[model samples]
Target: MSSGTSNGEHRYVIIGNGIAGTTAAEHIRKADGAASIKLLTNEPHPLYNRIALPPFLKQKIARQKVTIHNEAWHAERNIDLMLEQTAVRVDPLAREVYLASGATLPYDTLLIATGGRANPLPNANGLQNVFNFQTLDDSLAILAQIERSESAVVIGGSYISYELTEAFRSRGLQTTWLMRGPRFLRRVLEAEGGALVDRIAGRHGVQVIHGVEIAEVRGQDGKVSEVVTSDGRVFPCQLLGVGVGITRNVDFLAGSGIETSSAVLTDQCLRSNVPGVFAAGDSAEYYDPYVGHPILMGTWDNATNHGKIVAQNMLGGEVPYDDVPTYSTTLFHNRIMAFGATPESNPDVEAVMWLDEASESYRRLFFQGERMVGGVIIGQRKGFPKLIDLIKQRTPIPVAEREQVLAQSVQ
Candidate 1:
């Protein structure tokens, strides 16, 4: 952590050094140059893109390519950055934060952007060769294991699992994907989308096991060898990758007056229930103007947007963030994009789809009567902008024109 003397002057303290906190620091510096600004983070390195870690693992990209900013960039702006320092507790009433090192720092305004941690496997300690993909450290650790092993078993069916499986396959490792659900990406993608992904993974020689759970991971000499499933099945692998899910990093704010349910509740302006306290990124559950309720979006885009909004609000500007939620992920040769709420989340919706199983191209437009509610596009990224516009504008595309619109060039 960088050393800085605390003064009695008004100060802004931001926790979490991801995109949210970094962007907030920049915006605050721009709006109020003289305001004392200090940023604390648990990570040792400068802010980097967590989304690009998969490509980095596959050797398609370098670590330097994923960094958002360098140390010199933050230093030039006069932003105090405290790296590898964890905020253990928050005294909202006292307007101070207690670090793990026993240092108490005061703040006139606070931004909580701690994000989320990778969910652990149930009875993880009893299991051997279990792993999770979340931070840079985790990615590096998994990459090391991949380099040393030939066969791997992945437990989970989310996008992270899909990406990691592809990475393993690209490196010539025999990969097995074990899922408890019937399909991959069950939470984000519809049945058709999940099937398309499964087909793509299968084409790449990935063994996918559906409706199965790993009961125990058997290993020898502190290394994994085989996994026993609940269905009386045994799969042998040298490595295990677990992508169960994520839980928001809000445990530190347990007794703080800030309101939280699932995540720290914030208004459209990114301000918490407690004045002068703001939240952004995965740790913040904010009300979306489109959805009309507090929703948790753990996307990088949402984190950046929240940082900008919270910075403006902290500087006495009344800027409310009402952005159309969007998220995308790439696996092997397939590109998937989703916008707004999923169809499962909004049951009062109908879909207009254009599917060509032969070409492996699919597009589904979600609607609530005449208004477009959301959309999912697989194998075609060009369709994202137009679909996003349609959802944002609430534009109605006639059932007959759905195919024509999707075929037309977005450019």
Candidate 2:
């Protein structure tokens, strides 16, 4: 039947209870006090900080520190929290959402913040040791295995895989990191930065294997023991972590009217082509005015902004979503941050590099003609704020003055 709320203060149904969905629910309540708001999530937990998950996975922090909102928090707000349920399909014409349990939920407004799912090995079957480090349960399970395991094979060279590689090596496990590319984050990291990452990984006890893909996952006693590469190299391991990235959680909207380009396509206002339908979080490719293009960014800051913008638009307010995307994390005893464009986005941008001793620390700033378009800062962040402002303001720096700018930036 149609359970869209008969009391009639306009029902809002949100899918996925991550940062984006939960934040949207909060803003919706603040905007309309009496509106019926219900949140549905496939995860049992209400809301937890996924950004801090790396440390949690490494067992550096207690599990309780990762959880932000609990069951009681949702109860006090009078928001219907449907846990362990997923949206199987969406009927835009009927304004109804169907769950796998065969229940139907009608809504006056719908937000598809389903985000993405962990992409796994192509031929991975029912195996006990292969794991993807995304959710809390996945992290907990990996930690438990880490406590007993002595060797780990991490596949994929993205940030997720590196985090796993760091954790395994830090815990004194014999770790081997495999990647399909010659370098980690090549699209984002400059050649020097990429080389630095390889150097750092090697120095930290991780055997960094480049330009290889796993062709087979062989197991003994139903647990993964070795992976054979496409080139016919076999690596033995007691545990495996795959970080091939995420598959956008938009497959359910295939027949729906919502347009999707790698993710749900939206304008600067976070509005989909279908009226009363909106998308946020990792699945929303909304316009980013700061970058002068429509881009999809999966970051804590991006999702947080999307929630506030969609909430305002859903309440009949006109506002534009603008942000300069950046991601910061510590890697192998070095602190690094990347802002603005990557090679995939701005391949031809001119660069200015400033390197420190041991080739271990440096910052590379990218520019398009006169305007700053991108940057990568390592081992130093005192100059990041000014550099980011230059990007936002489209400030032009003379070619001759670029070197002096970096020199004075740290001073």
Candidate 3:
């Protein structure tokens, strides 16, 4: 198949309407006015804010507020919006995408942004009151269940689990946080960091048990009633929130020759091994030039930036993604911020840490040689912006000045 149509106009087909794919579609329309753009998503609704779902669950925001774009928005830009269409196969050689609905789409350049599916756990299948908090629909169903729930159990140790913990506690549900790992963010934060999180959750009246896995869930009347752990302990609850992890949606590319490890493997340009095929968002594990390795960051900011950069590259620009990725969110009443590479993601880097139990604050800086690569700050936000600048510029800090930098950052 030819790359372009008979008249030379380009065809762009993007899968997944998350921030990554949607942003790419928006920018592509801006740059190439005449390009035929088709945006696809398996979801039934238009583009919505996944980040806001937590707040919506807490009744801080209305359901409609979570939506970022309406169908009319795509119509205004003359972009074809295809919803509830799951791409089942990709014929990269023929530049065609086969959908589950028996529809075929041909593209000159294709962007695979089908983000991910929530990883399911055993006993969660076909079970009522057991939920995965990954989508707007999940959150909505959870919100409805919360109205009838008196107790909640949150599983996993990732950010999603933390969000579930906070939401349940905020709603006055007797909440129990369960994790197989010893602590939260086990890979990124140390024991002291985990203790801080425990203290925060405790202050909010949350029961946190660690190093235990879910053995079996006991239900009554087709609804979850209690959970039994591997250690043979049982905790009664009306709702279960599972945030184990996510499986990147790349199964359709199984034989399409798209190189994938944890996700679609792309270079700094966000281009897959095959020409004219690109990836973005959580689906793309692109090589990070700054970190000197391939990394997958699934933050909204990272995905949004990926869309912008990938759009330029898909339009024949050789631009490489260089944005510094950062994530900042509120935990209970405190702030948790992390940016760039961390000890969890890159073990080769050396780390320095400081903690103050009285103030409930902690800071850890990661260094490679003399340059600051990444850092995590919990509690205070005094020097977060400065640290981002230092990492972005690759500023060098001498060993003698390392402690001084940390002390001054908090002030």
The candidates, ranked best first by lDDT, are: 3, 2, 1
lDDT of 1 by residue, 1-411 (tens): 122236444588999989999999999999877778899899888889998998998989998888878889889999999999999999988888999999998888889999999888875555445688888988888888888888988888887788778888988999889999988767556677678878988999998888999888888877788888879888888888888888888899989989988889998888899988999988999877655667788788889988888898888878988777777888568777777766544655676666668867777766655567677777756657667777778677676765566567233
Q: Who wins the TM-score comparison?
A: 3
**Model 3: per-residue lDDT, tens digit, 163-208?**
9999999999999999999998887788999999999999999999
* Candidate ranking (TM-score, best to worst): 3, 2, 1
Provide the RMSD of all predictions against the true structure, rounded to 1 decimal: 3.4, 2.6, 1.5
TM-score of every prediction relative to native = 0.92, 0.94, 0.97
Model 1, residue 138: distance off in Å is: 0.7
Assess each prediction's global lDDT (C-alpha) against the native. Answer: 0.81, 0.84, 0.90
Instruction: Name the weakest run of 10 consecutive residues (lDDT summed) in model 3.
Output: 1-10
Residue pairs with colliding backbones in model 2 are: none
Clash count, one per candidate? 0, 0, 0
Best by lDDT: 3
Model 2, 1-411: lDDT tens digits are: 123566758889999899899999989888888888889999989999998888887778888999999999888888899999989999989999999999999898899998889998777777888999889999888888998798999999788898889888887899999999878886666677778888888988889988899899999989988889889989888899999989889999998888998899999988899988899989898876645666777778878878888888877777887667787888879877878775545576777887775646778877766777777777868778888888788787888877777776666
